[model samples]
Each structure stands twice: as structure tokens, then as C-alpha cells.
Target: MELHALLSYTFFLLFLFVIAGETVWANEEDRKVANGGFRPTKLFVFGDSYSDTGNNPKSLASSWKTPYGVTFPGKPAGRYSDGRILTDYVARFMGIKSPLPYQWKKYGENKLQYGINFACGGTGVFDTGNMQPNMSTQIGFLEGLIKQTVYTKRDLDSSLALVTVSGNDYGAYTASGGPEQGLPSFISRVVNQMGINLKRIHDMGVRKVVVTALQPVGCLPKQTIFSSYQQCNETDNSAATLHNQLLQQAVTTLNNSTKGSSFLVLDLFSSFNTVLKNKGDFTGSLKFDTPLKPCCVGKKGDANCGSLDENGKALYTVCNEPGSTFFWDSLHPSEAGWRAVYLTLRSSLNQIYN
Candidate 1:
């Protein structure tokens, strides 16, 4: 690829690494049972790279390259972190192995019992520049599986759906010349579509569907790096705040109208805020000395976490201790960062059983 195009692609992937947050293993028995009566037997994931295991093709996605999954699985496994992500943690919390990625469906028949993941790294609710399937299309893929009997209504009834819509939509919007003054209206549109998507998943017979509220995009290393990794840009944060507020209202409406109110929001904005405020010092145990600084970065401009030079030499620098850094790249979080956020989210996640 030409340098310019490759650089754009890398930056695109970087900005889309939004649900970024895990690393520690909880005791298996601790997650053996849920707090509520409804226990999910399977997990169906949708949205972006945060939950994607290996959906995006290797040739184009950096997640399939070296240094991405170095902290876990011993190599790149299409997870955009040093190790596991929110999806894996959620599965662990439910006492189940992480579901196989949808890309592996034809090959891993026996693993279907866990569920399928349809998330792609550089995707969003709307078609972003990444060219991956949009949220509507991703959901359509699930619908196709149901039509093929890959998943039955009974399977969905016992399943939980995880929908992550971090910041790729906004990334796409801004990149496409969207005006800052018009951001609130665009955010409204995104949240409105998200509500519709949630209802669609529920209509497909999934008893519970959990969607993520927008995280504080301003706090990601992508934005903070411009400030010398010292502070966040409140303008981006205000946009995320608006998105979360609108999403909360939308979810409430969906719940009030649906039977059993199967819709839930993960409150990523609050979770991220808490973790960043504490600098990964969750419960006074976990700590990321440089919470806003990424663990891996390009050696120079336009390079990325996994960038390689023309001679195939690595052009990125990885931290000596990835576990101490919150972000793994310009946008995504390290496993330790995610683990800290998950600790705070565990109580909220337990509500899925209710």
C-alpha cells in the first residue's frame, strides 16, 4: 500500500478502537452463578473492535498482526488489546468461555454453543470509511444465521446480546466533514438508530440485549496525545456525554415498552470516567501509572501500534510493561486498563440476570 493510504487506514483503525478496556482472571467459581434468576447460556456480540474476536480479515486489520494480542494467546488473535477485552470479561463473568468469532462459524461447529461474534474492528452503526459492515448489516448477518437455523429462537431465548457502539460513528462523521456545530443533531441520529437496533435484536428473540453507552472519547490516547498525554479534550467528551444521555433516554423508552424490559445500557461513559479519575486505581489495588498514555505507539507520525516499514521492520514501540498502561494504542485500552474498568462494571453487569 502507498504510505499515505496506509497511514489513513491505520489512523482509521486507531480511532475506531473504542470499547477499550481487561487482563486479570477472576476465579472461575466466582462467576459460576449470576445474581438474578435469568442466566444466559450464550452470548451474541455485535458492534466494533472492542468485542470482535477475529472478524476482520487479517490482510487489512492491524488486530491480525504482531504486538496486538501479545499479552494473551501469545500472539495476535484479532483482539485489539494486549490481551482480552470487554466481551471476554463479560463471558467470564457469566461463567462461560468467550464465544467464537462469527468468522470462525463454519469451522468451529462445536463452539457454537457459546455464541457468535459479528463485531468488526473499524465499524460503527453507520458505514464508516473502514468499509466493514455497518451495524444494520452486522445484525443482518445474525438474521441470516437464524434463517439458516444456525441459531434457533430457543437459543436466543437463553442468549445475551452485547452491542458496543463506542465512537466510530462519530469518528466517521467528523472525518467526512461533519461540522462540530452540528454534532448534537448527529449524535441524536446515532442514538435513535441504536434504539432501533436494540429492538431488532430483541425482536429476534434474544431475551436480553446490552448496548454500551459512549465512552469518554476525549480521554482516549488518540485525543490526549495531542495534549502531551496530560489531559482530555472536553469538546469531544461533551459530545460523548450527549450521546450517552440520549442513549439512556432511548433505552429507558425501549424498556418501558418492551415485555420484561430486556434492554440494558453498559454505561461505558461512567465506567471510563471512574477508571480514568482513579488512574486505574480501582479499589486501591489496580493501577496504571500513565492511564491516558498508550502502551504501544508509532515511532513517528502516521505509524501505528503494529506498523511495519517497507523492509518489514517494526515501526512501532511497545512498552516494557503493557500491564501498567491503560491504553494499548492511540485509541484502544490495554488488558490491565480493561480489567480495572470491568471491576467497576461487574455490579452493573450482574443486572442482566434481573
Candidate 2:
């Protein structure tokens, strides 16, 4: 065989091996959960791109473009990242297939009976930069379902809701002449609104709700690219810490006020930090040496990611293996990176599952 053909075959074999190993790992995880005696029936998701599963209108999102879903499912399915996000993993942990995105309603109805995802990319509790639906609007979609009798009160009685408010609101705040000194107040407002949203969902009939604490926003590739993706900016992390603290307190207050501790908080910041600290062991199928580096990036400081000319000429270079890297782009994680975080969250979820 020619050198090129030989190299291609070798790479294919390696890819197959990595996929097989991940399958085994996932199976083991399932067995562990089963033995521990936990089973959850439904998962309802709401948030931004991180948990969005194609809810964004196709014309409005770059996630619908090529290379977004190159790693899994073979095409862009509207996920902000390369593959599954936290919603998919949480659905898996619940022992049910990932529920379809709310936008895919016409595609199937069986999954909708289980649950629906209401997340949209670039959305926040308050209107952010994007014209897409904000958290209130997203919940309005769910409320419409109830009003239309799509999801009956009984359906929601046994359901679980996963709410993610990643930092889009903060991003919007920073861009719109909002003072950095007032970020603490903004954080309070965000959490306060989040608590209201959670209560509304619970009151609407959902049994248990899980809200994710903000991840280490300052550590994302977008913020750390200047550091060559080697070190997290402590300043950013400190800000995130404040946000998480307020969120934790809000969650506790919500639970207490509800007279039942049905609310749960998933700590993404700590989990992401743990994976960053032990990067070697959590290598994805692609065996990336530096998981922090993005797999696809804009060229020459342009604002586009992996852009190409009209003739399809390449304008960006892809990393060696997307699976090996934790981040697929400046703002999101690779599937493997999400999987590692899911593993760490197994215990936290068990609290809700039980």
C-alpha cells in the first residue's frame, strides 16, 4: 500500500479502538449505577447552547454547519458542541434515551412523551445579545404545552427538569456597558430569577429539578487562548466562584422554601477543574495531548471558526483528534470532555435519582 493509504488505515484502526474502549467504559458505568439501585424515568432539559440539542432555528445557528457534529452522529444536529452535551449524559444516567429537542417535535412524538429540551443557544434569564428566546421565553414554550394540554399534569408529576444557565447573561452584561464592579449584583439578579424559574417549573408540576452551577467561565478556551490554553485566568475563576456561591445559596433557599429538598445543584466548576487537573487519564478517543486547546479555531484572528471560502478551500486547521481534546471550540467541550464530567457527576445525580 502507498504511505498515505497505510497511514489512513492505521488511523482508522486507532479510532475504532478508542470508540470500543469508550463503549466498555460506558457499560461499566451503567452496571455500577444499576448495582447501586437507582432508576429515573424522564429528563426535561432547559438552558443555552451547552444543553441545547438543535432547538435553535437552523438559519440562526452556526452549530447547524459542518464539523459541529463531525465526531458523533456524522452531521450537525444543532448541538453547540461536537456531540452530546450535559442533557444527553443526564438522560443516559436516568436510564432513558436522550429526549428529542423541542424543535424536533414533528420528527417524532414518542420521545416527547418522555420529555423535551427547551434550551436555545445565546439565551439567558434576561434577554442577552441574541434575538433568540430568553429563559422566560423558553419556559413560556413549556407553559404553552401545559395550556394546550400537550403535557398533562400527570406527565409532569413523574418528570425531572434540568436547568442550565451558563454565562451568556454575564457575557451580555459585559458587552452592554454594564459595569464590572456591579457583576455581583448582576449575579444576584440572575440567581434570583433562576430561583423564580425553578419554582415556576416545580409549581407547574415537575417533581424534581436540577440546576447546574456555573462552570469556571474564566478557564474556557476563549478566555485562556491568550495563555496558549495552558493556564486558567484566576480572575475569571474568582468571578465564577462568586456566581456559584450565590447560586448555591439560592438553591438552598429554594429547597427550604418549597418545604421539600427537591432542588439539586450540579457543580460543573469543580468537575471541570478536576478534569483539567488530571488531563492525562481523561484522554478522549483521539488521545489529544492538550485537552484545553480547541479542535477548530478561526484563522488570522478572524471571528469565524474553521471558515472556508466559497470554493470550500480551507481557512482553518483542525486539531489532530477532536475526541482527545476537551474543548471542541473556544466555548464548548468535546464529547469526551463532557463524558468525564458526567462520570464525576454520577454521585451528585444519584441524590436526585434516589
Candidate 3:
């Protein structure tokens, strides 16, 4: 009887251990699924400057210069603004580090797990203006990786993508003598190409894709400087609204056609407007007395922000505090400005996570 009692006690202890182990394992699995799991071990990015975390060549971009990265990392790490960009913030939200630039092949093995960013500043889907790789060629780079077996089917199944098609294509259109009268038609073409690019990315096996809608262009410092950066041109925002509406329709159609409705749109319009309305937040990073005003400007319209003379003298002047301004230069947002926009996107990301 004594031997039997001892044996029963041992079995009871074993049962408790099994239950505890199962609980821990279940919790881990829940976390993985909630954070998008191991399937997407990488994030493949393609877009313009808004998401370009240093894919542009050093010789070509002034982002490699000083004072561009004075805020966060305390050094120029190739990010366009004072610190992190949309890609970096999104990567953090997805529980992964921002990937290396595709051009930086030297760090390939070390950064392979996170994926790559192929975005080049001043690029668009149609190649309407800039000489950089169009959306298709950017995907070609991804295809080259696959051909080399750098990423497998399983990797893609678990991977996600962020595509940004800022208004560069439209800007290019206007620069190339495309008439304002044909702006609506050109906008449609841009969205159509973007939709095609989305389909191509999905077809290439990325499980989820998030794209940004155009921000308020007229509100950009370059455009609103005429109004002293204190007001947003409703005319430009109206154009953005029309573009976003068409983009929404495109996304809906893509979702209906795709296997799992994987396409998501990040609304930059509302996000930018939110911060502009609030002036600044608790951090005091953006104290925009004149929100549309850019921190740097050319002295005599000789060059835009980041311009340097033959002797390397700066042609533009910076404001007292870049953190106090919404527009970084004439085109992009300050880091603080992007952070404000990121706050507004929290809910949209939640949809993707769910």
C-alpha cells in the first residue's frame, strides 16, 4: 500500500508539469500569430522617399549628408529626415527591424533575415519623370533575388511588403509638360499603374501589402510658401481627395479579386491634417507657428533644400529648430511630422495585425 501511494504521487506531479508546459507553449504560439508569425521573416519594400530608408545611392542623394540624422541616431544613416521614416516605424509596429537597403549588398548575409528596401527617392510607378527604377524594375530586383534562391516560397508566404507611390509620378507628369487640363486622366493612369503594381506584388507571393495614399500636396512647403506656410491650398487637397477615392475603389476591387484581401491603404491625408490642426504634441517636436513653412529654403531660387555650391557652401538656410516645423525641406515632412502621422495610423495597422 505504501509503494502504491508513492507511485500515485509521482504521477500527479508529472501531470502538473505537463499542464504547465502546454500553457507556456500555447502562449508563445498566440504571440507569434498575433505578430504575423515566422512566415514573413522579411519585409520587402518598394517606393519613393516616404519609405526609402537609404536605397538611393550615396552619390545621388543629399540624405547622406550631415544634419539630416541629427535627431535619433545622432548620425547620417541614410534616412531622408532627422530620424526614422515610415518604413522604420512600420517595421517596428510589425515586430521586426527595418531591413537593409537593396543596394547595400555588403551587409547581405547579416541582414538577410529582415529583408530589403528597394525604394529610391524620386521614383514612381510609371517612370513619368525621374530616371530611377520604375515600380516594375524594382520588382525585377526582387525577382533576381528569387532566381538566386535568396528567398523561397515559404519566406514569401510569411513575408510582407510596403509600397509607397507618393505624388512624384504626378509631379513628373507636370514637369514633362503634361497639361493641367489632363490632370484627372493622368491621375487615373497613375492609380491604374499602382493597382497593377499591387497585383504584381501579391502575385509574387507577398502575403500582405500596405501602400500610402498621396498626402496634401498643395500644403507642401513648396506650394504653400506663397501663403507663408500658414494655410493649405484646398485645390491641391481636392486633387488628393479625388486620387484617394479612386485608390480606395482600386483597393476594394483588388481585395474582391484576391484570395485573401491582403491590400491595405495608409491614409496620409487625414494623418497630416491631424497634426497640422493640433499644431504640436506633448513632445514639442513640432511647434509649427506656420505649419506649411519648410525649415530650409534657397536664398535666390538657385537651389532647393540640400543644395550646395561649388565650394560646398549651403545654398539654403535651416530654421531655428527643424523639430518645430512640419515640412522638413520643401517636399518631405520632418521626423516629428512623420511621427504625428504614425500615431494616426495606429488603428489602420491594427486591421492588418488582426
Number of the top-ranking candidate, with TM-score as the measure: 1
- Return model 2's CA RMSD, one decimal: 9.4
- The digit string of per-residue lDDT tens for model 3 on 56-147 reads 77787867776676665666667777767888767665556678888887544566777889998888887855577878899889988988
lDDT of 2 by residue, 264-320 (tens): 889999888878777833434334468678887877676455467889876666676
Instruction: For residues 1-354, write the lDDT of model 1, one tens digit per residue.
Output: 001111111111111111223233455222534333677988999999888889999999999999989988779999999888999888877666788788876634566888888999999988998888988999998999899888888999999999999899899899899998998999899899999999999999999999988889999888998988999999889888888889889988999998775988888888888888888746877787778899999988899999999999999999999988888999888888888878877767766767
> Best-fitting candidate, measured by lDDT?
1
| Each candidate: RMSD | 10.1, 9.4, 11.2
What do the candidate models score in CA lDDT, each in turn? Answer: 0.83, 0.76, 0.75
Q: How close is candidate 3 to the true structure, as a TM-score?
A: 0.85
Rate residue 4 of model 2 by lDDT: 13
Task: Give the Å error, residue 259, model 2.
Answer: 4.1
Tell me the spans in candidate 2 whose CA falls farther than 4 Å from its real position. 1-28, 31-39, 107-109, 280-288, 310-312
TM-score, per-candidate, Cα-based:
0.90, 0.87, 0.85
